[model samples]
Target: MKLRILGCSGGIGGDRRTTSILIDEDILIDCGTGVGNLSVEEMRKLRHVFLTHTHLDHIATLPLLVDTLFNDLHDRPLVIHALEESMEIIKQHIFNWQIWPDFFELPDKSRPSIEFQAMSAGETRELQGRTIEMIPVNHSVPGVGYRIQNDTGSFAFSGDTTTNDTLWEVLNRHDGLDMLVIECAFSNSEKQLSDLAGHYCPETLIADMSKLRHRPRVFITHLKPGEEDQTFQEITEGLRGFDVVRLHSEDHFQL
Candidate 1:
C-alpha cells in the first residue's frame, strides 16, 4: 500500500494545509484543505472518504470536492464513511441547503452525488483489498482514528486525539503496525490550551506513547503553524528510542 500526505498542519498559512491523507489513489482519511492540492484527474480517482470528526480543518473541502465533481459523481457517488454523529453535523451544518446544496439529495434523490455510511467504533470496512478499522478516541467531539491494513503491511492514523487509552489499546490488538501518523498540535508552552482543545503537546503525547507496545515509524503531524519546529523538537527529545519524524505535506511512503 502507498500512503501520501496531502496536508498535516494544525492551521493553515502559506503552504500549510490542515489534515488530509490519501491511501493509494482511492481512499481518503480526511477531506481537509490539503485536498485542494489535487488536480481534477486526481480528484476523479477518489472513491471513499473516512472522517475523523466534524472539525472544520478536517472536513473543510468535502462540500467543495463533491460540487466540483458533481458531473462525474452522477453514476458513482462518493462514499463517505464516518461516525453517525459526524455525519449528522455535516448534514445540519455543512451540506444543509442554507450552507451548501445537500448533495445527498442533489442530482435527484434517486441517485445522489454523495452517500454517507455511518460506522461505529470497532467496526471495520473492506474496500478492494484494504481493511479500515475505526477506533474511538477522545476529542472535543465524537472522534475516531483509523487502522488500515493490506496484505503487505499495516499503518494507523490517530485522527485528532488527546491522551487516551482506547487508541493505544485498540492498536495493540493488531499483530503489528508498520507506521503511525499521530498529532501533536501544540508546543509545551501551550500545554494547557492543548488539553482544553483536546489536542496533544509533546509532554502529554509522550506520556500516552508509553501505553503502546509496538514501536512503529512515528510521524508527528498537526503541529501548529508557527510552533512546528519547537513542538517537533520537544517530541524528538522525549521520544528518543523511537524512530520519529515530522510529517510534511506531499511526503509519500510505501508499505
Candidate 2:
C-alpha cells in the first residue's frame, strides 16, 4: 500500500491545506482544498473518497472535484463514503443546487456522477484489495477514524479526534499497526481552546497515546497554521519510544 499526503493542515492559506490523504491511487482519506493541487488527470484517477467529518476544511473540495471531472467520467463514477449524517450534510448543504450545481444530478439523474455510501463505525468495507474499517472517535460532530489493511501491513488514521476511550481501545485491538497518523491541532498552552474545539493538544494526546499497546512510527498531522512550530516541538518532546515525525505535503510512505 502506498500513501500520499495531499494536504495535512488544520486550516488553509499560503501552502497549507486541510487534511486529505491519497491511499495508493484509488482511495482518498479526505477531500480538502489540497485536492485542488491535483490536475484533472489525477482527479480522474480517483474512484473512492472517505471523509472524516462534515467540516468544510475536510470536505470542501469534493463538490468542485465532481464538477471539474463530470464530463470526463464516462464509465467512471466517484463514491463518497462516510456516515449517514455526513452524507446528509453534503447533499443538503453543499450539492443542493444553491451552493453548487448538483453534479450528481447533472449529465442526467439516471446515471449520476457521484454516489453517497453511508458507513457505520466498526463496519469493515472492502475497497480495491484492502479491508477498510471505520472506528468511532471523539469529535465535535459525528466523526470517525479509519484502519486500512492489505496482506502486507495495516495503517490507521485518527481523523480529527481528541482524547477518547474507543479510539485507543480499537487501535490496541488490532495486533500489528505499521503507522499511526494522529492529530495534535494545538499546543499544550492552548489546551482549553483545543478541548472546546474537540481537537487534541500535545498533553492531551500524550495522555491518550500512553494507552496504546503497539509502538508504530507515529506521525503528527493537522496542526493549525500559526501553531505548527510549538505543536510539533511539544509532540517531539512528549512521545518517547515512538519515532515521531511531523507530516509535510510531499511525504510518501509504502506499507
Candidate 3:
C-alpha cells in the first residue's frame, strides 16, 4: 500500500500542517489543515476519511473538503469513520449548522452528501486488499491509532497518544511491523505540560517505546512547530538503539 504524509506537525504555521495522511488515493487517515495542500482534483478523488479524534487540528479541513467536492460526489456520499464518541463531537460541534452546514443534510437527507460510520477498536476493514485496523490509544479525547497492512508489509500510526499499554500490546500481536509513525509533541523541558496535555515528551516516549518487542523504523511525528529541533534531538539522544527518523509533510512510503 502507498501512504502519503499530508502533514505531521503538532501545530500549523510556515510549511507545517496539522496532521493528515493520504492512503493510496482514496482513503485519508485524518482530515487536518494539511489537506488544503491537495488540489481540488485530488480532493475529489478522496472517498473515505478515517478520523483519529475530534480535535480541530485533525478535522479542521473536513468540512471544507466536503464543501469543495460536494458536486463531484454524485456516485456516493463521502464516508467519515470514527469512534462513537468522536463522531458525537463532530456531529454536535462541527457538522452542526451553527458551525458549518451539515453535509449530511445538504441537498437533503435522503440523498445526503456525507455519512458517518462508527468503528470500534480492534475492528479491521479491508479495502482493495489493504487492511486497516483501529487500535485504541490513550489521549485527552477519544482517539485511536491505525494499523495498515497488506501482503508485502505493514505500518502503524500512533495518532496523538502518550504512554499507553494498549497500543504497544496491539502492535506486538503482529508478526511483522515495518514502520511506526508516533508522536512526541514537546521537549523534555515541557514534561509537565506534555503530561497534562496528554502528549509525550522524549522522556515519556522513550520509556513507553521500550515496551515494544518488534523493532520497526520509528518516525517521530507531531512535534511542536517551534520546538522541532530540540524535541527531535532529545528523541535521538534517548532512543539510541532504534532506527528513528523525523516525519515531514509530503513524505511517501510504500509498505
Candidate 4:
C-alpha cells in the first residue's frame, strides 16, 4: 500500500495544507484542505473517504468534493466511513442544507451522490486486499485512529488525539507495524493548551510513545502552523531511541 501525505499541518499557510492522507488512488483517510490540490480526474477516482472526526481542519474539503463530483457520482455514490457521532455532526452541521446542500438527499434520496456508513471502535473492514481498522482515541469530539494493513506491511494513523492508551494497545496487538503517522500539534511551551484541546505537544507525544511495543518508523504530523519548528525540535531533543520524522505535504510512504 502506498500512503500519500496530501496535508499534515494543524493549520494552513503557504505550502502547508490541513490533515488529508490519500491511500493510493481510491481511499482517503481524511478530506482536509489538501484534497483541493487534486485534479478533476484524480478527484473522480476517489471511492472511499474515512473520517476521524468532524473537525473543520480534518473534513473541510468533503462537501466541496461531493459537490464537484455530484454529476459523476449519480451512478456510484461516494462511500464515507466514520464514527456514528462524527457522521451525526457532519449531517447536522456540514452537509445540512444550510451549510451545504445535503448531498445525501440531493438529486434523489434513493440514490444520492454520497453515502455514510457508520463504523464503531474496534470494528475492522476489509476492502480489496487491505484491512482498515478503527480504534478509539482521546479527543474533544468523538474521534478515532485507523490502522491499515495489506500484504506488504501495516501502518497506523492517529487522526487527532492527546495522551491515549487505546491507540497504543491496539497497535501493539499487531506485529509488523511499519509506520505510525501520529500527531504532535503543539510545542512544548503549549503543553497545557495541547492537553485541553485534545492534542499532543512534543513532550506529551514523546511520553506516550513509550507505551508502544513495536518500533515503527514514527512520522510526526499536524504540527500547529507557526510552531512547527519548535515542536519538531522538542521531539528531536526529547524523543530518544525512536525513528521520528516530521511529515510534510507530498511525502509518500510505500508500505
Kindly give the number of clashing pairs for every candidate.
Answer: 0, 0, 0, 0
Per-prediction TM-score, please? 0.99, 0.97, 0.98, 0.99
lDDT for each residue of candidate 1 in 90-116, tens digit (9 for 90 to 100):
999998899899999989899999999
> For all the candidates, what are their Cα RMSDs to the real structure?
0.6, 1.1, 0.9, 0.7
Native-to-model Cα distance after best TM-score fit, residue 167 in candidate 1, in Å: 0.5
lDDT of 4 by residue, 156-213 (tens): 9999999999999999988769999999999989889999999999888988999999
Estimate candidate 4's alpha-carbon lDDT, on a 0 to 1 scale. Answer: 0.93
Off by over 4 Å in 2: none
What lDDT would candidate 3 get against the real structure? Answer: 0.92
**Residue pairs in candidate 1 whose N, alpha carbon or C atoms collide under 3 angstroms:** none
Model 3, stretches more than 4 Å misplaced? none
Which residue pairs show collisions in model 2?
Answer: none
Error of 3 at 250 (Å): 0.9
Q: Residue pairs in steric clash, candidate 4?
A: none
